[model samples]
Target: MRTVAGAPVRAGLPTPVVTYALMAINVAVFLITALQAQSVMDNGRGFVNPLSGAAVFDSDLFGRWVLSPLDVADGDWMRVLGSGFLHFGLVHLAVNMFALYILGRDTELVLGRSRYVCVYLISLLGGSASVMAFENGGFTAGASGAIFGIMGAQAVILLKLRRSPAPVIGVIAINVIISVTVPGISLFGHMGGLVAGAAAAAALLYAPQWLGAGQDRAKAVRIGWIGLAVVAIVTLGLIAVRAAQLRSEYGL
Candidate 1:
């Protein structure tokens, strides 16, 4: 692809192809679901609206998984992760996918593919967990939470390198402003993802290491693994707490 400002794009950078693919998937899923919504409503067949606040925890596609909004309030717990993958409208999906493209490519370049994926998933989950914590009865759907997490990760990495984080901080601040000024945006989810991303990035990029002078490269790898572990534990803890809450509510 062509780079902006007439510069050639480097071929060796971590391209974030997976990130792009994820965006595509989210868009596609939203489109298909939207169409489905239209079809059902148009048919007037007395079909219950899946988008209804009541359908969330209902079993679907083999009754094995709970969906969002409904499950979020019903305390299905799993919906915290599942909800991140759903979107309410075209603009919602587009904004998130764009953010992912812009921030994800650079994060992948800095952290490599595996670590990049780890950060994204953790951030996504973190955002969802935040939503569950703060909002209990609304139908919330979007990728902003995960995208914020990625931004947080980028900021953490830049800070560790002693690079100026002014630009990034500015971007984050602007986004936060937009989120708050605009109606229907989940400020809680976005802030949650941002905090989670920062924590994960700090563990990954700045934890103390014990490598000798000649073993800097190896030390970096070790630190990354440790950071990943920390992030995983924290993320799982959040999910578990949400799950427990759900179970208690449902008496399951």
Candidate 2:
């Protein structure tokens, strides 16, 4: 299987431990969503409301957890990060988890732990920013944005190494097509992730070389930490600024 292909380690390299852990966490979160959904459906206080047609998660715990643009504008900025881990439903969770496992495993190994984590957070925030800017509405959650970023990062490094990016580009193209054609899909989020992932990976791959520390694992780790900090700061700033604008314009 393609997923299995991404799992094996080579030349005594470390296993993709973080990748596996992330997959597990995603699954665990999905289980929570599922149970919550079931409770909502069972209780008379909830279900798909006839008026709004939105499922009421009993106490609305799950609903509150979504990346609500209005709520975000009110300073619930944590949703930008939290929403990446939340899925709307079972199918949504399954597909994203599958993609995460496949792409994350390989990317994690190639980038190593520190760099991989940095790329992921940056990409996730990128996607969140795009959604906040454009999608502007109820909660949108999924790991597709981050997964797309991983692919973009991989492509950037491969190109830098003079490797063929045809397969990677092909996959990205297909996904982009789907994002545009499919209903209820976040086109901006995917594109945001693509750009962010590529940018972060480029920094990781080239920054060290520029510093004359090419291939130095320790130096790479240091750069990864610094890069992550920079990305986090920039992301938070964007979210804060955009959220204020949204609040003012929309009166949230």
Candidate 3:
């Protein structure tokens, strides 16, 4: 088990408090959206009208909270973070929460709580930025983006330990395939999260060693944070650029 700043790795590790807290927040947000939507079971009306094959969330809260390029262009920047917590329906919420629970626990152990939070948030922001850049229009919502980031972080940890990353790669490949083939999935968001998460994890896992501070836990943690800040700044810059483009093009 690799330790960071007195935080032990996987073996007999402390409770994954941050992971649990994140899961709780996601669930609570989902419940609120479900209540507002008046339907928790179906993310879209496809269940109500299987013949139409149109997927639409029953909740109006989705529009206000979902990551919409137009809304972001209009300066609703909060949606970038808020949409990561909102879910379209029960199924969407359940799948994302399960993934978060599984990947987040190990990720929290590998990166420690503070670093784990940074990776998760940066991944979320990365996903939102990608959506803002490439997705011309639509309301996107779900934790899949952040979950994909956790997957990427786990892959980075495996590489750091000289362990095979085949399993994680396989999962990512499958998810990517689904994102491509699925009608409503956000491919850009998932890819963005994956790249951001891997980059953040790589920094947290390797920057200390590169800076000759691996043995010094305090310095290592500080360097890791600095690395995260770099990733965050870049992600924010991308968001700003995309938002400006949208505003300029749409005359918003």
Candidate 4:
């Protein structure tokens, strides 16, 4: 039987619980934020009706949950994770949730639920770390970082299967360009997620080769965790270093 990362390719695999759960949570969070902000179609310029283009109230979620360098430096650490779930507006949330739905399914299929979650969370933190490092001031929020990571994982998995990763690479390139050119997009967050996702996926997919162990499921899982742990540690360290710099610079 053909296998992916030593996991047998079988029919009737379980549902992608993590992916759906994430989507639901994101939607729930957006509803709460939108209700509080008194607007469902919030945007950078302000909220608006997508159909009639009528102006609406501004979103308040960013104020509370966005990852701000100064706020992080002042020890608002939860923002690092919270920001990943926060979105600027309806369009932002819809785009990210769509990407997550598309990428999350295949990734969960290949990496399994647990490993996929590892890659997602680490990539999110990596994105937040990048924002802290480079974005001096202002707010950053959304799951684009995590979505980019999922895209990265798809690319890596294709390569591991000895297939051309041209498709995903093209997708990534287009998105990268958009990030660079778009006014409100977070380029650092996307790039950081891509790097972290690729690293984590590589660890999980290539764990057997690196560990010099046969394609045993148990051993592969263990080594994959080790790889993820390493990535997590590196991400946390970067966050710490950047936070310290901001604190010292701001005298916070």
Candidate 5:
């Protein structure tokens, strides 16, 4: 892919290709889930429990629903990351993918594919962690948190490069405002992801030069890994606490 300037986009850089690829993956996953749902219903199966709560781990959709980090502790750990790609409805999916398309492609082009992917994944984990931290006993699904993290990383990059961040900042502000006004949004997840993105970007794009010639790159990797760890820890902690509570309350 080439930038609008007609310059050949370098290999290994963040590009529209990667952005679209991720979007396609997300969409494909959603389609598969929907199809599975159809098959289950056709076979006389029904989702008896609906997930409630904004926390990703604490939320459960019936006893069988398994798309939360808390489920991981119970041997359903896959949901820790899987939940980021799932969505509750078309509008939810569309909004996130659109945001990812617009911000992710451009950001990837600037940061290179490696850094871009790191930022995105870290942001996603951060969002999930935040949801687990604050809200319990509710099912939450969507990519808004991760997408917001991208926006946050972009803003940090602009600031680090000493470029005007007005455009990006304005966009982020608008989205945040909308999230507040809109009902059924996960404020905790979005905010957490945004903060994590900013922190990761700062560590990667800023930081003392004496750290090393490859210090920035190293920092980015560390940030991503650490962010994931933080999310996982908080999610598991919430599950343990909730489980204990349940045992006490219901004598389970």
Candidate 6:
């Protein structure tokens, strides 16, 4: 059956627990960032109405939590993880969370919890890594990268299941269009997330078969872990090299 989330959910699939949890986590982090921003903006009090366009930024809070390629080079690599949970404004937070609620549900169901989590992390970090490697320094924050990653993974699932991949591709195309037409979207971040998600999903699904990880379930499991470990290392190494290049070229 066709679905907007890229594939149909089966009749008896358990609730998408991981999906719900991720949405909750994103919302929670946004709350923290919002409070921090409010304190920064309003004489150390509560949040401002972003809808009123009166919100002020806390550069210190943003720099600490948002992903900055330069900050990453200086050993604040944790920002890569934190940035996915941060957002520029309430509208940004709302849009990303909504998208996550939609895509994460079907994705977690199809990929299962463990692989779903891995794909999300890979996509998120991949986007940060790309931002670190290519973009100029700024406070880049949002879960769109992870969301794009889910979209890519979902497309892969539909293709594997012999379903048309057009809907996902179309969604991606529309997103790219919007990103280009609108201001402030991270293009490379989205691209990196989508590619990484697709790669991670393919690795998870096919590594066992490719490695001939046959009847020995234990052996197959080990191989899968090993493959992911190798990919993680490679990802870090590439990011380091690119980041170094950026620093050296710009003298930053």
Question: Which residue pairs overlap in candidate 3's backbone?
Answer: none
What lDDT does each candidate get? 0.66, 0.75, 0.83, 0.83, 0.64, 0.74
Cα RMSD for predicted model 6: 6.4
Per-residue alpha-carbon lDDT of model 3 for 140-198, expressed as tens digits? 88888888989998888888888999999999999999999989999999999999888
Pick by lDDT: 2 or 4, better one = 4
Give the TM-scores of the predictions, in the order they appear: 0.78, 0.83, 0.89, 0.89, 0.71, 0.83
Instruction: Tell me each candidate's RMSD, in Å, in order.
Output: 6.1, 5.1, 4.4, 5.6, 6.7, 6.4
Q: Lowest summed-lDDT stretch of 10 residues in model 3?
A: 42-51
Worst 10 residues of 2 by lDDT: 1-10
lDDT of 4 at 100: 95
Q: In candidate 3, which residue ranges exceed 4 Å CA deviation? A: 1-6, 9-13, 42-60
Candidate 5 lowest-lDDT run of ten: 54-63
**Model 4, which residues run further than 4 Å from truth?**
1-3, 6-13, 43-61
TM-score of 2: 0.83
Error of 5 at 22 (Å): 0.9
Show pairs that collide, candidate 2.
Answer: none
Angstrom error at residue 207, model 3: 1.9
Candidate 1, residues 1-252, lDDT tens digits: the string is 322111235567546776877787776656555565553222111224668623322223212122243354454656666667666555666777878888888777676666677777788778877776677655555678888888898888887777888898999999999989999788988998898887777777666342332336556667667777888788768767776676587665
On residues 13-36, what C-alpha lDDT tens digit does candidate 6 reach at each position?
A: 579888788888877776676676
Query: Which segments of candidate 1 are over 4 A away from where they belong?
Result: 1-14, 39-53, 56-77, 208-216, 249-252
How does model 5 score by TM-score?
0.71
